[model samples]
Target: MNKHFYQKCIASALALIMFFSLFAGANPAKAEAALNINADGAILVDGETGKVLYEKNADSVLGIASMTKMMTEYILLDAVKKGKVKWDQEYTPSDLVYKISQNRDLSNVPLRADGKYNVRELYDAMAIYSANAATIAIAEIIGGSETNFVKMMNEKAGKLGLKDFKFVNSSGLNNRDYKGEQPQGTGAEDENVMSARAVAKLAFHLINDFPDVLKTASTPKKTFREGTEDRIEMINWNWMLPELDYGYQGMDGLKTGTTDFAGYCFTGTAGRDGKRFITVVQNAKDSSGKGGYKARFDETRKMMDYAFSNYSKEKIVPKHYQVKGQKTIPVIKGKENEVKIYTKSAINMIVHNGDEKNYQPVLVLDKKKINKDGKLTAPIKKGEKVGYVTVKPKNGEKVSFLTGEDQIQVDVIAAQDVEKANWFVLMMRGVGNFFGDVWHGIASTVKGWFK
Candidate 1:
């Protein structure tokens, strides 16, 4: 029996290997973080459409650990955007930042006192190494104290329209007061947590808002000095940076973070053929001294592999192309008449081997099933919703995403369906209602009058 069990195990392993080898890129396995990645929240999206491809507990609120620095970089970049600071701007570690670094917090690039560091040096240090000191210096240099810097972080979060997120610290570290105790939910606290989806969205906005950061964050390794101080060499913490051929070398600039509470989190992007994909994974196990980090990297590679393998930007339907009949639908009691819908999302689909024109399509709408009459009942105004479609492949799950198909809402007031209210049509409806009302009214009136 033991021998048989061994044989089965060996056969299973072989089968798994063969499966991977055969179906390497067939369809992206619903992106579940692989073994060792016990992260509770995660998301994967196409960089082009910003459409989420897969998510698990994405909006779930959880501590983000040091991943908070991504926001720090964003705020600093905003300053640069406002011309408040130049790329070569000289920023010095303030007395406040120096003290924080002296405490030797979770992650810091210790800056020596009596020395000045440029913005570029600090940016690279924090970006490549997740240095605690580097982050504090940036906080102090940007906003006088990490406290003020943290407020700036919240402002940026607000600007990003982050609904499920709040900023308490410039770093992902837990908030601590002067006594080295955790602060309880007040004033730029470090207890800020966000869902995986929110973090991904934040990362996506950063990429869109500041594409330049990647040039440094994506570096495999770099060495730099601050004001002629000892040179610090730092390497990226994202393990995925080296494993995949296409995603690795071309990939640039992002943040990696980990803490006992937040596990490991990484947000990064890579481009091929001018098409880029931004990926966010949180709570990934990062036992660096152990072998857990590799699994996280492997999972990222798998997601990227699936995205590039299956999706390529293709225009499924041209703008203003009549899909069914009309452009808009009527929606009563809604903000607008008929809601106009169109797919601004470029259908990123992969087609091969004579399967070009064989794509079968179906549309679906946001409104619930309607049976008011055989068709949509009146009251739908211009810009009111109707339905959507499912664009199915010949062999697989239907593709329900199209630019104009899903948004085929009716333009209620675009033209009057009344069509001069044909006398015959009005008479039939009026007669049906009049007889029903006459009988009910007589019964009610007789009962009331008798009483």
Candidate 2:
């Protein structure tokens, strides 16, 4: 294949691999399979539980188009959460904002350079319409300047544990100098990219950390009729909504993005029977780029359906649980004779019912472990981490890492250092100690009563 063909082929192949890895899970025969896609990277995870249900190159960093808007939402909502801004706060657009909003990379908010909008309208334009101008307006309102706001965005991402992505601009529009010299969102400075997993994670924070934002994002089929400039047509780019697909009625608001470097991308959420899930699709094809959102909607539905149909978040093993280890070891002075280590996640693997028996929990003990056995000795302290019990769905499941328990400080010590004497000696000592103890006891009793 030519270099162009090679790149295209790799992109295609990577998309497929990531798609299967994400959605398919460990079981192949389970009928609850999701839709397939050509996105270079993808991931689907339970939003409420943080369980990764399906993931494509979910970890592979790729350009995410307007999905950057979600970060904008995060920053603004974070401000709202901290009382830095509010739903009704009004902000005026500066000339720099107006000048930048006019760029083709932005959605026309119809606001003049000096036009003022409340936080509500700015949020609406930005969330519902993915308005670039609205983003600048919101950024300025929150950060006192676009540069300052973008700085805050990067900081928040860091605090949230988003390592692969960064922001150099508020709108994520690639800035190019007069010579067209700077690359599009690919400059040495333009480092705004994220993996599907991280994007879904950020969405998790957005929906969970600030549900009000989701309330705004989920406004499917909003009618933008501002001052009647022909009520310029603006429809949600996400198809996984009631207005677009009845089956996807349970789906809620999220953000979408696309850039040639990142391809078509979306970070979305949906629910069914109280079980909600988040999804990320990167380099998912609009293949034609005419906005490949339809493919995203279709693929998202498949993954969500698969999750609800096959998995039910069952708690298989209750706590106070121990997955017997491969070997038991001695501790120095622990209250318990031996410590049991297990996996931290749970004995509950996302397995199909048919193969449930095939999986076995393993007692995984590490040779390096050496804690005093609780039964030996201690000023028993409760809740001190001892060791953990872990379970694996399959025996050879890479010997899933160990999980340890806090040393449950039992009240009694197993053995005291005081020694026991022979019968005769014990008798003599007992008689002597008895006489002394009795004399002392009587004396103490008399003294206490007198006092």
**How many clashing residue pairs, candidate 2?**
43
Q: Give a tens-digit lDDT track for model 2, residues 143-185.
A: 8876787778878888887767867667655544112322223
lDDT at 39, model 2: 75
> Number of the top candidate by lDDT?
2
Candidates in order, TM-scores: namely: 0.63, 0.66
**Model 2 per-residue lDDT at 319:** 44
Local accuracy by lDDT, each model: 0.61, 0.63
* Candidate of highest TM-score: 2
lDDT of residue 389 for candidate 1: 40
Tens digit of per-residue lDDT, candidate 1, span 218-306 = 77777767334576566667655654333464466466677666666667677886567766667665445332455456556656665
